[model samples]
Target: MAKAKPNNKVDPNKYLKNKDIEPEGKLGVAAAVGRMGLMLVGIVGIATEFFRDDGWLKAALGKLFESTSSMMLIPVIIFVLWLLNRWMSSESKSETKKSGDIPMYAMMAVGAYYLFKLITTGSL
Candidate 1:
């Protein structure tokens, strides 16, 4: 009688090669979504500045500032980013961060561009 072949196939372990690696599941999806949101907000801010005026962006930001204390905004953003980074890289065996952190980098770039636009327009 012929022996039946074992059928369960396992994916190659990514952690084996890279000691510190980011996963490609819900964590990646969440990070991508966050980055996309930030990018969209930046695009809208710039569009408002060009199409309408800086008042819309300023009003939107003003409302945000009014609701939350100015001191907490920067700290909260930093904490959130740090938390996400830690959570995403928690599976890695080493302390070193892996490359290909695209979403995070893109989000940061968008934030910088948005701030530059606001500053240049004297909106902030």
Candidate 2:
């Protein structure tokens, strides 16, 4: 009796149909950029405080929050970024694009407001 050869090849159509597989390249790059930006911000802020002559602890805390509005804005920025990332990483093809894209636009509006405020008042 002859031995049957085992199937070693995966069907491309079936592989593509599997929703569990995430598309590569751009997804990883976006995550890397976000992480690097956060690290760079932290490093700059820490270096600034370390090089200053004033009381580091109090000044660092004060500069971190700045004010109630600034403190609130921090979480909102984080949430918006996370939401956008999740939406981008979703593998669902049937999802309607228009239903969940509002956060980015809303963030843009908030960003514009902050930029205008900074320009006019010289402070955020």
Candidate 3:
């Protein structure tokens, strides 16, 4: 019987000590950019659809919410309250607030306004 030959291939992982570092090669950069482009396109498309007055998404949401009777606002209120709690309770004690929190603050204000209006007028 013939003896088996030894495998000579080197394991690349043995040389790569820091796996957390991103590859600096052209292929890696291209792949990263391609992924970012796809994500940006998808986000833009969704935003456009949401902004359009006659979009199917808006129409569908309107139809669905019409029968819910203030139930839809419950989730929005809960989410805004959660965001406020998270922002206030963050470990980092930074004097300046993040720009991302602007949208959350706006949502909280709007939700509070609607809640106040609902209580006062007894209508949506």
Predicted model with the maximum TM-score: 3
Best by lDDT: 1
Q: How close is candidate 3 to the true structure, as a TM-score?
A: 0.37
Q: Residue 59 in model 1: shift from native, Å?
A: 21
Q: Model-by-model lDDT, in order?
A: 0.69, 0.64, 0.65
lDDT tens digits by residue: candidate 2, 64-124: 6888766777778889988877776546867656646565455445555555655689754
Candidate 3 backbone collisions, by pair:
none
Q: How close is every model to the real structure, measured as TM-score?
A: 0.29, 0.30, 0.37
Report the lDDT tens digits of candidate 1 across residue range 1-124. Answer: 9999998888679457786776689988998877776677666665766456546667766766886577478788889998877756746576545443655576568666877767789662
lDDT of 2 at 93: 63
Estimate, for each residue in 7-77, the C-alpha lDDT of model 3 and write its tens digit. 98899798577867775999889976755554454455455556787886888677767776655886887
State how far residue 42 of model 1 sits from its true place (Å): 0.7
Candidate 1: lDDT of 4? 100
Which pairs clash inside model 2? none
Model 2: residues >4 Å from true position, as ranges? 1-7, 10-96
